[model samples]
Target: MNEPLRTLPSIDRLLGHPQVQGLLAQFSREAVVDLARQVVEDARATASQGQPVPSLDTLAQRVARLAEHRWRAGPRRVINATGVVLHTNLGRAPLSADALHAMQEVALGYSDLEMDVEEGERGSRQEHVRYLLCALTGAEDALVVNNNASAVLLGLAALARGKEVIVSRGEAVEIGGGFRIPDVLRQSGATLVEVGTTNRTYLSDYENALTPNTSAILRVHRSNFRLLGFTHEPPLGDLVALGHSKGVPVLHDLGSGCLLDTAAFGLAHEPMPQESIRAGADLVFFSGDKLLGAPQAGIVVGKRSLVRMLARHPLARAVRIDKVSLAGLSATLLHYLKGEAVAKIPIWQMLSRPLEGLHQTAHKWQEAIGPRAQVRKGESTIGGGSLPGETLPTWLVALSAEGVPGGAKELARRLRSHTPPVIARIQEEQVVLDPRTVLPDEEQALLAAVRWALGA
Candidate 1:
């Protein structure tokens, strides 16, 4: 075998590449010089240690790797492949086109964030969403924070800190990313008094737990899971009555609070906030980013007194949202005001995309590249750690090996590695192209990826 000859380019020469310059901003001058020194040290150290030193060109690659360590944005865009819309991994629900438009308008310029234009004086940021939220949810008042967790924290801290909070053991949930109920309680300085078994908690159980020291009853939605056999939980109305009779308010934390009950549209039913309020929940906390299909925000809506108390809490300042979140959320609530919530929310649009329409989309992909692919039906998920058991009906295209086995995995890898990666599910040794999440224009790319992976 002939010994391989190597041509080593100089470090200074290799830095001239555009890619290197693109990443150099990630590191400071001193850091860049230090990274360069390491490269030289390693190359020299390998020579002295009787090892084949990597060439100077290879050394430049090493410096680039080092630069990524010092500076990189934490978030990256990924295609939601696993047939999951609102994928928690993919940053949950996507913003609606209307919401995005609002974001662009606000994000691009200075707007009256804290100014009352009509009054010609400084104003509260809360006004933007308060009336809209109240109008949509039938609440006397409303407040928007950074996320649901913060909303819950502010409510609990304001209402129950230095007091006891009675809760059903079953509703004491620990959901995605290890966000436990007990932890939120601890941080809020509210003591949790478990009332009943994890599977069953009655109205009496909550009544017995309440006392003068009890400031509130906390009801959490068991949205992620449903209990089957031997299941019994008190209705919200009954629980509210019991708490109010004892001069304590009831707070319900609805994890995936829907603006509309999706089952009405032929999907699994998610409880809406209006229903919860009408059920007499004294205060309600819900996620703005989940089923609502807006920006990441936690909305608290309830009786004006309780909302006012929450607004005064010191923790509310810490959990306050920025102008952009307020902008996006206010616009989302306006859609609700116009009775356009479902049609304007992106996550809802994907969820409510008719099966017939999905079939047509899959058929379009099939026709777009006739005979080069196979389109079929598959189920998609409403992810974001919201709905786990329920799989929404969707249509898909199944791309398999032209003449080879195990082609699905190869196709998956190719889609994931493409420019602006395409995420698709793999099932039964075939690459499943879910039309539920893919934009119509991207069908060409999807077909191209499938055919390329099939080696067509």
Candidate 2:
């Protein structure tokens, strides 16, 4: 054996170390043993490569770190200093307090998820949120699935399988994560018949595309992107009229699921499910998390017969929402029904924050972060594939990297590595933290994390 390899500690010896013992107390014995073996194997490989193996203490510490990393339950809580409300990568749309409480209540104990307490019979989990959805969207009925993609898949499979679904060429887009409309249609066993140009599609385009095999007319809202200047597409009501005239149902995919009017908040108007239903769309689909500010879910609201058909489909069972998410969604909808969404939902609260308040918050952060940080004007976007190119004016606490070890990128990395990771953005080589997206209660922690990242 090589001298360095011979110096490697045995797995048994490493497992007996204090740090490894700490790991064992926190995790399973089998898991810790496996990690220790992995660490020792890594050290042996390093020694074989003509590199010195770490000491026994270092090896044991490595095992502990590996165990902690492997065992820590994740999708962990993070502070969003990035100013991107509805950040898809960070688990979009921080849940409202009511929604979080509802999730906790259901997760902590047994829920009547599929039980009919009033009649002493088996029931459906969908019943919890169906009525609330209908009440909120003014639909005759409603159905929910795991997410917007699954909802689209279920709707297409149940309604248009083995038939032709007509969609505008402009609306057949690929949103974030490569979720293409044509791909989804093909997956649902439906044929996609594209009509008209990408920048302009008229009511005549739909009228000309109608055929005996036409199953449905799909209207996908361009929620994530916009075509400016020369863009023209028939309105929802026009398409609805055309569909009804030909006895074909119109299915509107309002991706962002905005319940409130965006224009009221100084943003361009985003299509709403209630407006679609009001415009005679047979069914309207939307996401629960994005602009709706709820848990991740795909919600469908429309005519009773259509919703009933969707509920009865086999795909419905496969894509049904879980009990915890259903509880959260229910509480979120109640915030809307009670007219308390602006005050209760986190995203809405962030959106409604006045510019003056944001400036004040940024100034406070700058004061706390010392001389290297300064208050600067910035913009906060409504991310998560909603309201593309729309930004809200805000103030940012910008930290310059002058004299710092590895510059702005390193500072941002250090902040992310901190406990309860802080997510910020870089602009002009400065680490910029937006006060708009950070929750009010997380201010102190954010300040501390920034201080640590700056090595103050």
Among these predicted structures, which one has the highest TM-score?
Answer: 2
Residues 1-456 of candidate 2 have per-residue lDDT tens digits of 687687788989998899888888887898888888888998888889988889988998788777767778997999999999999999999988889999999999998999999999999888898888888889999998999989888999999999999999999999669889999999999999999999999999999999999999999988888889898998889999999998999999988888999999988888888898899999999999999999999999999998899999998988989999999999999999999999999999999999999998888888888999999888999988898999999999889988788888888899999998999999999999999999989999999998888884
Deviation from native of the Cα of residue 160 in model 2, angstroms:
0.9
Pull out the clashing pairs in model 2.
Answer: none
Per-residue lDDT of candidate 1, residues 120-183 (tens digit) = 9998889999998888889999999999988998898898888898888888888657898888
Off by over 4 Å in 1: 1-28, 34-52, 62-76, 369-372, 401-407, 448-456
Clashes of each: 1, 0
Candidate 1 similarity to native, TM-score: 0.88
